[model samples]
Target: MEVTNLVVLPAVLAFFVLCLYFITKVVRLGKHPNLNLPPGRLGWPIVGETFDFMRTMNEGNVLRFIQERVEKYDARVFKTSMFGDPVVVFCGPAGNKFLFSNENKNVQVWWPSSVRKLLRLSLVNKVGDEAKMVRRLLMSFLNAETLRNYLPKMDSIAQRHIDTYWEGKEQVFVYPIVQLYTFELACCLFLSIEDSDHISKLSLKFDEFLKGMIGFPLNIPGTRFHRAMKAADAIRKEIRMILKKRKVDLEEKRASATQDLLSHMLVTSDPSGRFTTEMEIIDNILLLLFAGHDTSRSVLSLVMKYLGQLPHVFEHVLKEQLEISQGKEAGQLLQLEDVQKMKYSWNVASEVMRLSPPVSGAYREAKEDFTYADYNIPKGWKLHWNTGSSHKDPALFSNPETFDASRFEGAGPTPFSYVPFGGGPRMCLGQEFARLEILVFMHNIVKRFKWDLVIPDEKFKYDPMLEPVEGLAIRLHPSHF
Candidate 1:
């Protein structure tokens, strides 16, 4: 009887505690003044609509969740709860402009608790002066000028990647192969981990890490986030091993400070002459891989998908690529000037982004109480944006459903209408890097082979970045063939 009581009592106490937590949140919601806070349901206590949002997103109908609300509420603006905070969503171009323009004034950048937990000390996790300072340091390496020097290296690696992975294969799953390529490139340029075996090991861990990027913040042993946290820790430990060696190498003048991102972070210091701590560098490098790798992979795979479906588009891309290839000899690498000439290919890439943006959008926390579009938004509320809204809005984009690369031909969609990479001051720091990588990838792909997607109308999943459920498989044919 005593043993039974012990088990039952603890269970009852836990249930009671949970009940109280929800009760408190529900009570707080009632106290949350009827302040014209946009029309939307708050869902269950504490969680609010986060589960629904995550579920809808995980299912890959990223726009559907928000669009259902917009259709149910107001097309321009609506309100909801996500990640345990009240959120006001600004829809369309106005939303993009409003949120982006008010980066520091009304709201600031925000990430989910899962992201926060994993990237606590990284640049994206910081705001105000720290964020500015770190962003400046990162941009120094990522900008167009710096990337110009890396172009040939990138071209060489891409060609080698194709030769090693895609050349001998008649058919290959493009997404995974390209993923390996991107991760490998990032390792080479970022950490100087050029060994293929080391990269394969890291890539295995990174795959586990990515699973947690959008999962529930469950830290239990079996959870995705748990596995991801472990993977990140393992990765950081690997980085530390290299960090120690790089320090010795740099001190001996055996490695250039500008050789790779790790070395750059090691040498570059703030106003106080304090270099970033090893942990900070590791965390931010993880963040960079978290941000940079997947977007490029998704874009590359999507480019393949679109080109395969539209032969005319492929022909145009092929012509542009041929011009550049003709300018270079058989084994020569692509130069920055070669990348600059890929205007049409870039346009096609842009169209792919517009149709299926890699990221759905982002979260912003309201810094001050304010009224927007006749709705009262309280302080500490989570403000969010859905780029898909603007990307597919008929009012903002003419025939938004169409895959017309010509849309980017001249003038393009309005200022913030095309926000695949986001907008404003808080825009992606890796924008230039993404451009360089994608254009380089486009150059490599078009010059090498023309391919077709095995699956028609491939379905995509989006924890955040839209990913095809199946790694995009393609039938590769050499340009010479």
Candidate 2:
């Protein structure tokens, strides 16, 4: 009887202790008196709605996911959990304005764990004054004067890429070749690595690295994340070797301080006499390489797709490009001013971006308790603002589904409505560089060839970034100038 009493007493005490712990947790969680959180389900515990979110993203129509939620909840701002965090998705231009305009105020920049782990020490991983300093340092190299200097080099690379990869082939895979072109350009301009074999090897590694950027942050072996982490390490090791050599060359006067981005990074310093650390430089270089190539690759590939599908638009682009070519002497590379003249072509690129944004949306985390759209948001909540909310809004863009470049003619899209490169303080630093690269590629390709899509209805899916499932094959018919 004493043994039974002892066992029962301990069991009851333990049960009471567990109940009290849960009660304390509940009281703490409910501390905010009259808290009115946004309307939506948290879904399954840790996994939450991430699977559904990713599934929709993979299916290439993430807008449907947002639309369904907005309708069901009947609210512009709705609550949901993603990637194991409570998320509040803000819809429409109002949401965009609030999030972008309020950077570092009530909110700050945030990225997924995959991005943070893979791109350690990059600008995306920075915030507050540190981010600003990095931006200024980077801008010293990516600024207007520097980009203008790269115009001819970009044109030269585009011409060479076309001659080697596209000129001889009757049919070619667009995405892979375009990827090669962008990657090669990035290597040359960023690291001064011009060797084809070296570039090819690095490109393979970057391919693996990029795959993990949006994948689940599982570091286990045999996972995409593992492969990406390994690739990042290899790429960093290669960059470190190059950095060591470049430092010696710069010191010996064999390399100019203004030679390339690597030199610029090595020599430039912030106003506070702060130089970026070695790891920071390597990580930023990796980030730039991915950003400098991948987003441009997507745009360039899509431009080709749209041009093939719409011959009229292709003709319009061709006419603008031909006029620019005609103004320049034979064998003379394009200048910045010449690229500026290709406005119609730019408009087409802009419209394509609007329809199929390279990045669907981005996230920001609340730094403190804040009120948005009459809803009380608690501290530490992840906030999301989708491009689809503005880019595809019928109110902002008339006949949003239709492909019309003329929409960008005069005043263009409303502020915060067209954010292919994002906006506010954290807007993409390489946007202008991408602009020059895309315009140069467009000018070269449209003037030289008129291509037809092998698959008229080729579908693209977003495995974090939009890509053609079949690599976007096209048949090339060379045009005589």
Runs off by more than 4 Å, candidate 1: 1-29
Off by over 4 Å in 2: 1-30
Residue 257, candidate 1: alpha-carbon lDDT:
93
Tens digits of lDDT, candidate 1, 254-350: 9999999999999999888878988889899989977878888888888888899999999988888888888888778877888888899889999
After superposition on all C-alphas, the RMSD of every candidate to the true structure, in Å, is 2.9, 6.7
lDDT scores in order: 0.84, 0.88
Candidate 2 has what TM-score?
0.94
Predicted candidate 2 versus true structure: per-residue lDDT over 302-386, tens digit per residue: 9999999999999999998888888889999988899889899999999999999888899999999999888998887889989
Clashes of 2: 0
